[model samples]
Target: METVSLTINGKKIVTEKGKRVLWAALENGIFIPHLCAIEENPLPFGSCRLCFVEIEGKKEPVASCTEEVTDGMIVDTRTESVLRLVRMAFKLIMSRHPIICRECPANKKCALQDISREMGFKLKPKRLPQILPDLPVDDSHSLFTYNPNLCVLCGLCVYICNEIVKEAILDFNFRGFITKVGTFKNRPLAESKCNSCLKCVEACPVGALSRK
Candidate 1:
């Protein structure tokens, strides 16, 4: 792999030529808030919109996951514009995810909790009303539980299930505010052809999918 050098947050770092800014910064010990970023997936959709970064000469911040690094590139991960976008993205994601962590399986082990602690953001955004899907918990799998109400719709579970695990059992169902990860025809996991690989549960950042 061809290597290139770039500057991120005043620190010069060298990385592979085609690496995305997100991976480059992360590998070099720079933390830019992100979700819905899977290194294996080449075509990132930037859905979470939390990895925004200010690049030199760019009019607006760009999602680092979808932006490839270039030699001698200058990147600022915490500019005013970057923070505005990241804070809003975090707020929007948290608006949909329930903040009741005490009873959740992930609890201290959740990614949202980590992001909250790292970014100094609240788990529940004030003024932004929570719009939970209020879907029923699917405990029929016998190995894990699926709680749609707590899902942040980061698409990690769906991508892992369909792309990595090749289970093809989970995807975004419905659209817009009502969207959620579900089986085809909205059937329960018990009726679907799930192999119980549990990759989806492991990929879940929040507690939407958790082991029993």
Candidate 2:
């Protein structure tokens, strides 16, 4: 495999050719906040919009998850502009996500919590008014629960279900702000004929899916 030389946050590194900046940074112990990155997936979804990084010569920051690492590339993961963008992205995700870490299953293990801690951002958004979703929790599955209100719509579960697990049992049910992960015809998990693999639950970044 060919290797590419690059500098991330002023640290010189070499990664496999064709690797994305997000994975390269992560593999080298450099953290770029992200949630919607699955390295095996051919195309990064970039739904979370949390992995913004500034590359030399670029006018605007680019999502590290979707940006392929190149030889001689210089990546800055902590630029002022990059932090501003990442902070806003975190805030936007928090605007809809309920802050219930004390009561939530994910709690300290949650991706949002990790991002908040790593980025020095608060869990609650100060600028945007919280628009809490009133969706009921789905405990129909014998092994797990689905809480749409706590969901960040990172799409990891959906991608894992359809692409990795090949279950095709879950997907985004609606459009826009009302969108959520759901079974076919909006059926309950018990009626969806899910095989109980629980990969989706395991892949979920937030506690939207959790063991019962």
Candidate 3:
């Protein structure tokens, strides 16, 4: 494993070459607001662009989840532009997520909630448009519930089930804004090959997937 040196927030740090900027900052106790970035998942989801970082010589803030560390890199994780991008991303995520945090089961443990507080942003919609049409809660499984309304479409479950678990039961159902996770033919998860392993439930960052 090759090593590279980079500067994050004016602190010089050395990391393995090809390490994702988000994980590198996190391992060193430097917080970079992010969601949909599971260390176990290899591919970058990039659905939530909250991990944007301003790198020297680069005109725009790059998605830290997809950017690899390089030698002599000057990375600014809290630049004005980077903060603006991250704040907007959190706002967009909250617009679709229900604002009634007090009643939510994952309120205290929610990554979205923690990151919003850290970034000094409110979870209120703030005029950002809502996403996905109304979706019914799939309570077919006795142990778990699936609510598409709270889903951020991070695809962590899809990746885990399809790639990691090799279950091939769960996947995105539609294209673009209409996309939603489901079993083939929209069948109930209990009726599908879910096996009730709860891997998908664990991968979900929001209360979209939860144990009943």
Candidate 4:
């Protein structure tokens, strides 16, 4: 494994080459908020924008969860502008998300819930439209149910399903805003040979997939 030297939060740290900025920051005792990246899982699902960081030589802020570290890299984990952007991103995520945290099974434990609280969004934004389309629910599976309306297109479900489970049961079905993760035939998740593993449900950071 190749090692790279990088500065995170003004602290010099060394990490292996190809290691993501998130890991490097973590290894250096610098915590950057994140939702989709997990230790047991190396796949960087940068759907949650909480991990945005400013690099000295980078043109734009990059998602730390996906951007790999390089030698002599300078990373800023906290800044006024970066904090503002993160707060805005958090607000946007919370706006479209259902206010089920109080009653959600994952309530206190949910990544989205924790991040929302950390960002100090005391009141939900009113700008986001509440017109959520009713998607067909799939409850035939024993382990979990599929709720498309709550999905944030994080892609963790598809990533875990395909990469970890080695089962290509879920994928994007359309393009742009219409894009949805679903079974290959567009059939209900229950009908697919999903094995009822519930890995997708575990990997999802939002209420999109859950065990009811």
**Cα-based TM-score, every candidate:** 0.96, 0.97, 0.92, 0.83
Candidate 2 clashing pairs, residues 3+ apart or interchain: none
User: Which residue window of length 10 is worst by lDDT in model 4?
Assistant: 122-131
For residues 1-212, write the lDDT of model 3, one tens digit per residue: 78999989898898988898888899888889877777776687888888999999999999989888889998888889998888888877777676657877677888888887787788775778755357788889989999887888888899989888999989898776567899999898889978888998987878888998
What is the C-alpha lDDT profile of model 2 across 96-182, one tens digit per residue?
Answer: 888988999998899999988888999999978999889878998899999999888888888898899898999999898888899
Better of 1 and 3 by lDDT: 1
Q: Considering every candidate listed, which one attains the maximal lDDT?
A: 2
- Which candidate wins on TM-score? 2
lDDT of 2: 0.91
Pairwise TM-score winner, candidates 2 and 4:
2
lDDT, model 1, position 91: 90
| Residue 67 error, candidate 1, Å | 0.7
TM-score for candidate 4: 0.83
Task: Flag the better candidate by TM-score, 1 or 3.
Answer: 1
C-alpha positional error of residue 120 in candidate 3 after TM-score superposition, expressed in Å = 0.5
- How do all the candidates rank in terms of TM-score, highest first? 2, 1, 3, 4
- lDDT for position 111 in model 2: 91
Tell me how far the alpha carbon of residue 167 in candidate 1 is from the true structure, in angstroms, after superposition: 2.3
